[model samples]
Target: MFSYRVEGTWRRLKRHGWSRQQPTRRAIERDEDVVDVWKKETWSRVRAPRWSVGPGSSSRTRPGSR
Candidate 1:
């Protein structure tokens, strides 16, 4: 067996037309259209401004103050 450095072996393989094979990428059990609609509407509701509570509200911390 001839001793060859990894870089030299890789370069030789590439020169001989060898290339890396990547696995096919895909999301399993995913619905792209439903995800898009949820992103557009439901996501907006998540970031929607919340109401601020104050003295004008019905909840009373001190009954004397009310």
Candidate 2:
């Protein structure tokens, strides 16, 4: 897991109301590729089951369920 401070050139640009620049077709395709990679990586590392258990698995019922 990684924690970032949410501060940087991109963050600052976003905070100051810099909209996403119009990307060229190639740039858009590249961005989509990056997003797909990130999505796959994220889901691959997720530990939760596809379906949630019932109330016995709830916070009040279980301590440190993971």
Clashes (backbone N, CA, C under 3 Å), per candidate, total: 0, 0
* Tens-digit lDDT track of model 1 for 3-58: 99999999999999998888687678789999999999999989869887654634
Best by lDDT: 1
lDDT tens digits, residue span 2-63, model 2: 65574675687788899668856575446876788988998678857676655443477676
- Estimate candidate 2's alpha-carbon lDDT, on a 0 to 1 scale: 0.70
User: For candidate 2, what is the TM-score?
Assistant: 0.27
How does each model score on TM-score?
0.36, 0.27
| Candidate 1: C-alpha RMSD after superposition | 13.8
Poorest lDDT segment (10 consecutive residues) of candidate 1: 57-66
TM-score of 1: 0.36
Assess candidate 1 and give its lDDT. 0.83
